[model samples]
Target: MPYQIQSYFLEIKKANLQKLRKDIWSDTPVPAILQVGDTRNNIAICYRGSYTREFRKRSYMVKFMEPNTFSDAHVIHLNAEYRDPSLFRNKLSLDFFQDLGVLSPESHHVNLIRNGSLKGVYLQLESVDEIFLKKRGLPLGPIFYAVGNGANFSLYKKGKRKKSLTSGYTKAFGNESDDKYLIELVKQVNNTPLTDFPRIIFKLIDIEKYARWLAGAVCTMNNDGFTHNYALYRNSKTGLFELIPWDYDATWGRKVSGGIMEVDYVPIGGKKTNHLSFLLLQVPEFRTLYRNILEEILETKFTVPYLTNKITSLHQTLRPHILRDPYKKKEIELFDGETEVIFQFIHDRSAYLKKRLKYLKS
Candidate 1:
């Protein structure tokens, strides 16, 4: 069966479009009309992402006005994915995380049309917010995004004490009072004595859930996911924090700039920058659990044969659209060969992890 790419039409005033382009760094959204099929709604559009803002084909964040939503999402991210030639890494990583029983945003490929002009293929990602939790039958809670390196679960940055404990995070959901929860979590993670760390941390976080998330990041080799490119939600019922993966275009053996990254680039536990993971691994029980999770994932999900089939299927589905895409037509050859690159990455990454399982044991 041929893959169907949903088409989104954006109607924006020429003045607003120029204003948005003039200040690529601004988060302010310009009023626009969006149409999908026969459905139409008012939306606020703005440029999103840090480095990708400079790209000719930039990404966008669309906010649907009240009483008007697209696919039950009040907000959605349209990623140009100009950096990743395959344009499959982010969705692939999110799906893999879901398979491991972790909460992750849903995404699919869609064609975006701006002012009747084809802007090429984009990955439409469901926003992780109150609606996301309600859709999954989960309770709403305080949600914070790790916006920068200061969200390393530490009170310091670059060997100096941080001026604010909440420097790297932006509260996405909840009131001003909810900020204390994240602040307290960071304090406990950094100041808890080694002998009493496990007892204290088990109350703050779900170790198994964190292990699964860590394992997913390790398998995908997402260098930036540990300290950033993720979200934390404190479950109101359980009062424990859980992780939600995000912004993973730089995974699956590729760097953010679309360059080749070695299979063993990131350590099994994760980057040392994250103090939470560091403290968790210090407890033997947590280390064992994390290692076991990685082993199970490697044996089942991360194998080359398993992923090759997935990569091949996605490659076939995207080929026709990719060839016709004006921005991507020049790199048709590179796009066609990306499946093999991803397969080789799976093979080498799995082998490296299998051999390094001993490190986790020690």
Candidate 2:
């Protein structure tokens, strides 16, 4: 139902496209216009992501501007979802997170046309900014994006110092002049001993809510969310930090970045270094809580029946457009086959986790 609603148009100058590709990594935005549902507004467009931007079909970050904008949103993201052969990875993951009560960006599939040529299907994600907080009735506190591959929340390696930890995040909203709270939190997380980790985590983060978010990520097998491809926000109301997941095209059994992730793969950073989980798992109570949450998710949201139905419905909705997409890389059969893979993953992953957990408690 999401992809069926409307077709969005992005019109930009031909020269700007060349410039955007030339300096793909730059934060500089090229001026453009975005039209959605009979409403048009001025938008600044920029190529987004580190690895995905280098791909032929690029993702984008769009900032809505001008006095007569269509909506109150200051920014939005267009994910090319190039790595996802299924193309429904982001949509399904975000939807699951929201269903579990995580405050995340709302995603809708869009038929994107650039300069009158069909670009293909894109996922339009609601930006995680002040507007997003207001819409969800969440406190607009400091929001920082865990950008780059180096965005690991570790006490070792890149997170050896406070400056190193904060450097990995790009602060999008709230006070830019001071990052004392963020620095202090990082220091506490890294320097605090394992013995005191569980008690202290309650002060800095909402452990129960965060556990649900973590469960969703682990069940989906999103290797990117823990240390990178996430937005960390400090809630002004609760005064605790929370994580929002991003870039999930690599999930659901297939590695988008050219590696095969097994059903038994550890979700906390996968093969990467993750100090946060390393410390948390050291705490017995936290480990128990996480295991419980994972079990609950497997019985409910991550079940084969639930996910298979969801994937089947989405595949039906998207199949027609995908067949006609000019920028599509794979064949129609591959697109259709991906839904089966998703269904298989749900069953296989749930069974694998159940067996793993039997030994985990001992």
Candidate 3:
């Protein structure tokens, strides 16, 4: 057996899926549980809405296996040895994101056992406000587009509006009107050799826009964002953007060994010496802008406390599991200190960038 009984319970607290059944074949096909796109495990999304203040009055969309639901879904392989791991992973990813500052849809654990056999693991996630390209517009997508030198974002021709704002240095176009400003920023990010000497000192950086992005970055790392993960959002008709993160099973500062967090920071220095700082250097103008933004926000009473409380409150009941094997457990240890690490990181970043980008100011 990959793990004993008690070991399974602890792992159950932190993992995405629960242990259900092991068919003689890995593909025996249970009718209830299914794979979730978020975890690549068999799953389903059920009802989600709103209830409490903490969750921004939003209800979670759940992933579960209901009886007799598989025929409609594309059949996929499940672990022959146990329940789905997605049960534990998604919530953990949310907890981390909320604490770190990325806006994640609400996530909760769903316990459903057919006749008390512990049949399935369910993830209740927050419903995202999507401005469908065909119906509305996808402006908010570029908010998390990770714009910089050498970064590439796929342009959707069909849904995209396809009107240019700036040409030559970079091309800015969106499939819809809502996407106009967002796409303009991402597409026209290249350093423009201005005709008149950058008339305004803070003209290059939009503090508000970058603050929103910095908050989102904290959410990304907490979610253990993978290369493919993207924050999807919608710029509501009201104009305020609604952002939600959708990816997990990659974070929590846990490596199989917990040796160290091996983050590939943006490259910096020069042509010969590349570094993670290069990500900032690519947008040197933005550095202090966000610093000022962060400062202004911190002065207000609304920031930090909500995020701090959210992560702390959910740390125990909401921890997700990281499986050593798809169907088994070696047990990953939980570090409560992740919140402090993240906050300190953002604070230090604000301080550092303020000094670094001071040159851009008058």
Candidate 4:
């Protein structure tokens, strides 16, 4: 069965397009007109991603002009997903997080057309911001994107004291006041004594949500998720921080460059660089909760049979469009065989985690 995907057309002035191409590192957006099924709106678009900007098929960040939005989303990410041959890892990881009751971005595959030419299959992701909160009926709060390795919830980076506590985060939605909150949280995470860590940390962040988010990241084995590639949102009702995952293309047994990775590469506790996760797991209660979350997900959503069906469905839905996509023509074989790779990873990862669940008890 063929999956129907919405197509978006973008028209940019030749001069603006040239400028955008010339300055691939620029954060500034270029003016463009976007049309989808008779609705046209002025938008600003810019290249998105770090190393991915150098790829032949680049991703884009599209911001809708004020008072206009696409499906209630003021901004959207059109990811080339050039690194993932399967082109399903990011969507899979996000859906997995959602299934685990974690607040995650919603995504779907879409065909992007620029200057009357097909830019190929792109995963359209809902941006995490104030609008995301409103749509989900959640109270408005500060949202920050962990943009670099320094976002490891530590007071120091590379053995040096960070000049600013919030060095690695970009405030996606928040005021100057929010920075103090994040700074305080990081200070508590790193400065609080081990004996007093649990109580203080618990009050600063939602431990249960953090555990689940940690388990989700561990399960997907996202190499960069713990340190960065995540969003922190302060829950207005609870006044505690919660996590939202992002940039998960380098997951599911694949490295950022699409190379195969050992299933057990990421430890059950997650990367050691993330001080928050490391500190939380030190408490027996948090460890047990995280283990339980992983166990439940493994028995249910992360199982071979369950995920095989998912991978198969996604592969089938994407196969037709992917084969027709000019950008991915050279890697059709890898795309075709990606399901098996993912299935193998699931089997190995589940067994590895089940065996290691004992470590959490101590």
* Top lDDT model: 4
Model 1, TM vs. native: 0.98
Task: For each candidate, give its TM-score against the true structure.
Answer: 0.98, 0.93, 0.42, 0.98
lDDT of each: 0.91, 0.78, 0.33, 0.91
RMSD of each: 1.0, 2.2, 12.5, 1.1
Clashing pairs in 1: none
lDDT of 2 at 194: 75
| Model 1 misplaced regions, further than 4 Å | 1-3
- List model 1 lDDT by residue over 229-341, tens digit each: 99999999999999999999999889998999988789878999999998899899899999999999999999887776677777888888888787998999999888888
Q: What TM-score, to 2 decimals, does candidate 3 have? A: 0.42
**TM-score computed on alpha carbons, candidate 2:** 0.93
Runs off by more than 4 Å, candidate 2: 1-5, 67-69, 158-163, 258-260, 267-272
* Candidate 2 vs 4: which has more TM-score: 4
- Tens digit of lDDT per residue, candidate 4, span 21-114? 9999998998999998998989999999999999999999999994468799999999999989999899999999998889999999988889
